[model samples]
Target: MIGKLGQTSRRYRDDARSATSRRLVIGATGVLTALLTVIQIAAMPAGPTPVRHPLAQGSVWDSVYTAAQAARGEATFRKTCAACHGDSLKGIDDAPPLTGTEFHKSWDGNSLSAIFTKINNDMPSDNPGTLSKPQVAEVVAFILQYNAYPAGKADLAASADSLGGIKFLPKP
Candidate 1:
């Protein structure tokens, strides 16, 4: 009986060693294959890159500031700004609305620059100024639409200096 038990123990140890060796072989093969694949990828040729303006800090308003832009802006606002401003752009429980008499009260006498600064500096509730200037302008256009303002031929300026020159006109 003792002889039989000693043989069983030896077999078990041999099996364990063989299993460990097999696992190491598989692991090494996998690492080598991965290394080869990465080398192949790095050897591939690169593609040409597109050109972009240096000071393109954000979006620049162009002649494209149309009804379509306003509509598009509205969609962006609804998805990103609606939670805080409500669907109507009126402030939510703790948030302020984007339009109406209350909105006018907060910004009517202010210049477009002031409005832009407020939005660019402190908007979107969760992530302010994170949006590009073009996105911010689109949002402004949507707010204007809600307040019954007319669309202009050009998009609002995208640059801070240009934005400062714009004045927020009170809706008639």
Candidate 2:
């Protein structure tokens, strides 16, 4: 009888251990699941972001993006804007700076479209009245790129309507 009782007690002990182990496993799984859920929620996309479009659609000058246009704009800026805007586009005397604090103030509460118009109408101080629409657009794009603005799919050349909405992020 005593031996039987001892075996029964051992069985009970084994059962208790199994129950505890199952509870522990369930608790650990719950924790892991909760953590995974949090991570998934955090990684979801949010807010306005650049809609990447191909270069053929537009370019830095055309008011859209096309690898071809950005390339062309780059060349245009080098030929025309490089003299006063500096090789790096930092800008020379009497020419409003294009990056850093000066850039922020020059464009505070302003629209890119307006900026484009100003450049198109009055630039190169020495030869202000002779730029073509596409040429002006290319130079404007170079300035945008210099200001650290990321390229978007659509070129910003057509009109100031869309450009007015995209606000500039001031640099430190």
Q: TM-score of every model?
A: 0.58, 0.56
Off by over 4 Å in 2: 1-67
Name the TM-score of candidate 2. 0.56
lDDT of 1 by residue, 1-172 (tens): 9999999999999999999999999999999999999999999766577334333222222222467668878888888888888888778798987777777777755656676667788887698878888777777777776776656576766555666544554432
Whole-model lDDT values for every prediction: 0.71, 0.67
lDDT by residue (58-120, candidate 2, tens digit) is 222224434455667788777777788777767788665677777777776576677777876
RMSD of 2: 7.6
Native-referenced Cα lDDT, model 2: 0.67
Off by over 4 Å in 1: 1-65
lDDT (Cα, 0-100) at 137 in candidate 1: 74
